[model samples]
Target: MKLPALLRRRAEPAEVGGVARLDRRTKNLTKRLHPGEVAIIHHSDLDRVSAEALVASGAGVVVNAVRSVSGRYPNLGPSILLEAGIPLIDDVGEDVFTLVTEGDRLVVDGDRLLDTEGAVVVSGTLVTTDVLEEQLEQARAGLSDQIDAFTLNTMTYLREEKELLLEGVGVPEIRTKIDGRHVLIVVRGYNYRGDLDVLRPYISEYKPLLIGVDGGADALLEAGYKPNMIIGDMDSCSDAALQSGAELVVHAYRDGRAPGVERVESLGLSAVVFPVLGTSEDAAMLLADSYGARLLVAVGTHYSLVEFLDKGREGMASTFLTRLRVGSKLVDAKGVSRIYRSQVKGWHLALLVLSGVVALVTALAMTDVGGAVGDLLLARLRDLAYWIKELLT
Candidate 1:
């Protein structure tokens, strides 16, 4: 049965089912739930993170607001719920909350479980040992892919400026200043914004050295945070970010060529170029690690093959090397949107009009006898009545 339908037909608290309201970020709320507490998972944007957190928190039944109906494409949400041996009520929508009050009675027939009033009860089992292992494996695999994609995509942009990336600059490598300090590395992407939102409070509390990888400098600025250092090939980074007071480090190839450095200099930004064998993000991490930075937090970093393919990268060697270089100092911010805010861009209309004009001109030039053919067709249409009369006579 559909989740919405099932929720609508749920028995009263005194009859069979118990109710637990779950409308917040699972990452934060999951830790609050006791074992076997019914959880309603909301926040569609962070579906994967929410599912994982809820399952880890040991929720008995996870009723999701955003889910794949009819299993067309298997989502991480339903899979996590199933693996947890938790009954998944899909497509419950908003109305599911209206059916039950804070205290309700509920029972699961598949697992032979029951909950009465505000008390938690389990009959068969909340989650089986085997299912937990399977879920863990799946989650691990998914996380690996996500990281791999992020690494490869970051490399694509680096490779375009390979010559500059390998050249080493003469900046004094301070190896002890950042020791014991939390270092947050920001890379610009959809997930980066969200992760930053969540990390803002933590940043204020911890006061981590904020490092922006290329375009990620703009991300930090947009988040109202000043970056301490900007590292990358310099392409895709905003002009304002370049001008921001952060020290700039351009990733250059080993041959003493620094492409991105020139752009930074052109913007009148002081920078030191470092020739490295890997990606800019990799360079950022390595530089921090080499300099004795304590903890390295990565945001919006790619980690999958598909993501790499989308970025048009060739290999994963650099990412592997960088990860090895950073080791345990890395903490990935894969889903940090539980706290971030962002502005929406409204330039789509202007771009769409420009695209339409370019396409129209290209089509006109490509056709043979384009204008003459169009004129002939118009004349024929105008003489259609004369031809019709002649045919009738």
Candidate 2:
């Protein structure tokens, strides 16, 4: 058993070099991270998903302005980085973002931040698996507090978003007709790829209206299918998806302020603006339901309490209200895929019976018993023909 971060011996300075990429948003930072670059971020309570993205990017070192493992929960982000052999410096302070420019060469000697001129720019506390693991344990004790906060946030959200619960949706008209049809709404969430893989058969058969929610459009594109419609803040989506000729709908604030609309228009593309108070997935569902879709299948949608918490959602009032409105038509693809089985078609059973008759005839022709049966069948056929002729006469 390793000692807690407090009890563990302080680590000595070790040199590591890279060009710095600084961002307040870890998601935005991960997108631009090149191989072997040092990533500087301001993410507090770094989650598992963000950590995995950083590791995949091959970030040499992470300089954090906020706590990486703040004892809020047993977040696996910091531990994953450490296990992947990525050095992490925590609590460097917000001023670091202002001081450091993107692409500036920097050195992280343990927690000491050194500039190109060899001057100490800033210092931080080094993070270790031992320290983060202990922090996680303590964070588990704060679960009740987290739950309370979540509940309060949810209640507040419900008060603000009561319109969704009462009114179905004022879904705008689109060229893609969805009435009385199955609509598949895809999201980039946990097990999304796997769930989509399992639903491949359903997808091919039903050919549902494919709606991608922000980054979910990229997910659908990666899976080799074009989205019929794309909806979201359009922040996390790529230029490729935006230009893929899919009808784009920008999710705007209720006050009609759309941050992503400008980006779309600047690219010489047109998109419809939808102002609503809910997640992108919720928007997709409401749109599908409002368009009179016969069924709604959600891919990678977060529904469970723990899942919402893991996703860092303070409240799920929108999800709750959206589900309430579209619950009857909605189905989670993952759940359906687990119980789905291939149905035997009429032609399949017909082919099976035909094969059995052919096999029986072939066997009969090969033996004396078979020859006798064949003769009897020929005689019966002749008799039937004679009787039909007599009836006609």
Candidate 3:
């Protein structure tokens, strides 16, 4: 089988500009990547969200130590990069992770990786839509296995968290008031950045009690908003976010051993430890509902089997059950933003400003000091008219 030259990029003889940015976790890499850099990643079966982020981040090239598209579930990431003209070198081998250090410069010419020291440390195959679609068609034939695996994971999640889902037990206590107010829970999931951009108006107008789950806090900060509360393991959160005066809630295992708690204490900031079942996002939703939030709006939430699988969970039992529990009050970011727009608009802002100026003029006209100032202005205008007539004569 042969692929077109357009489908695969050939080696460029010129030494191009690229600083290697490496990380095993695709999400972590996306957070740090900048434009014109080469991303050295180890994401196998990369999801669309991660791929989109990479493209948005403007990485010139991506060299993966594992398969970008392993013919699993029609992953659209590779296809997106292909459409955007981004080069993705797949399965360069795990040894590349060690050989390439952060900030190390590298020249990526087709399948070859040349270090600044002039050593070819890694190489792999170039991926294109044609290649991915062919592989996706083959992987689709094995869809039954994926479905079966997904079902088993769901069943296990339902069984283990039956009590919380049914009886509404183990909900955490929180200080930030949520009763009768809109609560927004943010996760650092796929397309979260774009979702937040769309929700900017809603966020400014309603000022919902903002909650960030782990790296989500950084996302919030990056988007020019401060989180009211941060809930997650300390592993991914930035120290600046912790000290940003937002209330901190550390997600811990049910047994009470919280690694994030230690990190918080080390940073000399006090945080409320939430020892609960499932993920931090689940706890955030439960907290909002328990505290009497009128509506719970969510950003970066994953609902599909592929989304959960991308998170590397065997099953999304906890998240699935949590969604079931958070039912009526919950709304997606897009849905809430659409609703909020009916009441908030650019013209409305212009009207408000116009009305404010009118009110200020009316108040000045009625005041004693304003009346004296107005008389002086009238006399000056008459004098100016007389002076203009004299000049004409």
Candidate 4:
């Protein structure tokens, strides 16, 4: 008789050992992750950002307490980890958290998680490329249902926040003047670093109002640009960024419970509380648009259906509607970076310098001083030729 589904054996496991780094929050855990450490996280449907961070942290193996891919949507995180040659042990159960402490020397042999004593602490499915692909396919099949949910949530928010969406009534006022200026709102999302690198020229030339959404404030700081205004729930942003003299806008719940305000106050900083029902990215857009920004440029903001679903937030629905509201003047920086070749190139600068030198020479040649300078330059060349010839001989 065939075995039941629960009784089925997992794929043959490979043995890999490292000191375990445990954190229920993947983002927080990533901060402490060192090279060759085992990352124990509880992130379900792991998003791209967290996955990329883990990969960058040089995590040797990832052990998830919950399902990495729940088949709700095709999230790109697990695929990234696999592609980075990082082994992933999936659905190891939350008991692993209680069973294993931080810095425990654990060995992941195929499906079994073992301790230094060779005792099986837990066992789970060793996720391979083929297994991940199958899960992705199933996840893709359910995307349509997710779209329906997204649309329904959008409609509900539209009905409740029509005044804020249509007229920008509830947006808090800030000291930074955005009138008739370009505004760059960064979110530290997909390809944010690359996007920011390409936008350096744009940022330099336009000098747009810089608005960092949560962790994006640190992104800007890392890129060597100071944000003029920092907006978000204040959870992920660093204390350094909050104290960087940027105007702080606390994105609060519609009921006026601004949790971020507490953090800001503890840091001896004041902030403008903008109470609204949406993600901070949405609020930033609405704030920029309402303030008469001539152009709104977004970096690392989720736009596609898969991206919205990958975020795993119902607030993404608000982001969708917010994009539509600001789509007229808003430009996704990723697309801009793809098409926006810097107008200034090396050859252009070289030709400009050559032209300036030529003009200076021509102008000097028109005077008696020019003839003397030319003769002196010719004598120096002749002397250099003579020295080279003497050395050769």
Candidate 5:
């Protein structure tokens, strides 16, 4: 098969290897790499954050599964890869793993890099001085727009929160009024879905107040749980979920006007709008604290400087301030999947069957099995009939 010109140069290659560092985020996936390790930069969310991080880390090359958005939208990730002098391999497929055996000499042929085993080597790179300067200039040019967008979004969210607080609506507070109660604050991003899956079983045990922030509300509803309250500017939220009996809180700026609040009112849903000076997540945390929550658990919230930057805003100041206001009550759920074990296992099937048998035996002992089973089945049929009737109604 004819290969790209870059790969042709590596027709004769050697072998080398190291720990396989897989980067799903555009942050520096290779920042922690040792001198000779191979960095595999997987485009997890296909965001620029992971790409930027990989470039800053200075890996030898970067194998990307993500299409570079056809070079539009100022993809900092691929730009970083190219400018950092890192070899870029596009769509090398899964077989590329065989060529990477810890420490193999690899050759970069355009978007394909192959090792001695004739497999592709995945690596990443760092942003060199030249690329850094260019990136800075771009950032400087876009700073004003970034700030304006941040301000507008912040104002929208804050107004919603103020209205919520002023209305004295019986919305579930972020913190528990009852001592020892826990509050789970959910956001959508990163490994959020995985984290929520891990935390699902504990929901019933801890009985934490479920508060969904924006898209997090849909996540909760999808997981078969209803949020006690929903907070944010109401962007990226589903209409059905917003009207699912959860109290709505819109965050707006201190100017006392909130467009999000207007929308909430237009929907005929009463919302408490609060004016705050930070991100919607920040406002949510602060409101949770003010409402007397005992403990706050944060899921999928941005934590690092790069992540904050990825939000395309000067979030550091507000995030810092928000943390100070609620740090004592905050517990991050990052990597929670590693810690929280699922209670149900494959072995539970036998127990479930046994329980069913026991119930059947008890029914047989109390009454005739034939009649009991027939009656129980009829009851279920009646329930289904009612559901159908409701649908028609």
Candidate 6:
């Protein structure tokens, strides 16, 4: 069982060199990470979504200030980096952040990070597939504890927000007509770009009310669709997205304290405040449900248990309850894309036209009057051809 897996470990190079792009926030760091640049991040227990972002950024090497795995329920980020053929140096300590400056060309030689002066700045574990698998196995044994944490968090959330969850009391009124329309909620989660690409057909057909959650608003823009509404804590999305004329719904704390409100106001823009206990994704869903959306199609949102945990949030508990609240009205984009056959295609139209032409010809050939008309037409075609031949000669 282990032999093939061991053999599947990719051949790693001894050294890699690139310009260093340093940021503690992996999300912000990814935006600036150019191809062949070294990304310096302090992220621990790196989640799948963030890892996917790093991979997509085309970072040549990653140097982390903390353990990427950290025995946190087998987070897939480190493994994803290694599988993408990008070297990950794990746990070089917080001192690396102080030692390394932005745009400094650095070299990863085995386990050591070297600066432009060829001096070793930090030494950390070069994470390989073997290390990743072993750490993941150890992390798997602690999943029961994680589940217990989730349960506790869920109960706490339910106790605190029961009225909002059950009665729909605090959901804000929006001018956007969500009632009797399909609503598409987009989140910047795992395989978001791919999900958006696959959903293009559905998006084009139904023209769902697009609700972008934070960075997901920027995602919608990148996918060439303007969001009808942008919802989140307001940190991840770009300023351009905020100014795109989409209705902004800022997710705030239960105390009515909204950090996004300040940012939106700073931009000379207005937004509706949604004071909710759950995540922005949950807030978007609840808002749609409250406004009487017919069907909710979720794109790039976390669905599986592993995914919830991978987000590194105890607050995913609210998402669990939120799903239960939404019930049958909610649908995954992947599921919809799989089951919903495209209603029309170029080939289908072409086939329809060809069938009509064939039916017309068959009808024309099968009747006596049609046969006489066909003979006369053929004689006229022959006479026209002879005239064309004479002209050519």
Candidate 1 worst ten-residue window by lDDT: 67-76
Give the Cα lDDT of each candidate. 0.62, 0.82, 0.79, 0.90, 0.62, 0.90
Q: Residues 1-393, candidate 6: write the lDDT tens digits.
A: 131354355876688989999999999999889999999999999997788889989999998999998986978788778778888889999998889899899999988999878899999998877777788889998989998999999999999989989999899888899998999999988667777888897889999999999999999999999999999999999999999999999999999999999999999999999999999999999999988999999988988888898988889989999999999999987444455556789999999999999999899999998899999999999999999999999
Candidate 4 clashing pairs, residues 3+ apart or interchain: 13-110, 14-110
Deviation (Å) of 353 in candidate 5: 6.2
TM-score of 2: 0.76
- Please give, for residues 147-203, the per-residue lDDT of candidate 3 as tens digits: 788777778767766776676566666677779999988887766777888888788
Per-residue CA lDDT of candidate 4, range 1-393, in tens? 222233233343468879999999888898889999999999999999899999999999999999999999989898788767788999999899899999899998887899999999999998876778788889888989898898899999999999999988988878999999999999989989889999987899999999999999999999999999999999988999999999999999999999999999999999999998999999999999999999999999998888888888987899888988997899988656566567898999999999999999998899999989998999999999999999999
Question: What is the alpha-carbon lDDT for the whole of candidate 1?
Answer: 0.62
Output the worst ten-in-a-row residue range by lDDT, candidate 2.
1-10
Candidate 4 contains a number of clashing pairs equal to: 2
Point out the higher-scoring one by TM-score: 2 or 4: 4
Candidate 5 or 3, higher lDDT: 3
| Model 2 lDDT per residue over 137-238, tens place | 788888788778777877776777666556754556677888999998998876677778788988999999999999889999999999999999999889
Q: How do the predictions measure up, each by TM-score?
A: 0.44, 0.76, 0.77, 0.85, 0.49, 0.85
Which sections of candidate 3 miss by over 4 Å?
Answer: 1-17, 116-119, 335-393
What is the alpha-carbon lDDT for the whole of candidate 4? 0.90
Count clashing residue pairs per candidate. 41, 1, 0, 2, 58, 0
Q: In terms of TM-score, how similar is model 4 to the real structure? A: 0.85
Candidate 2's error at 215, in angstroms? 0.9
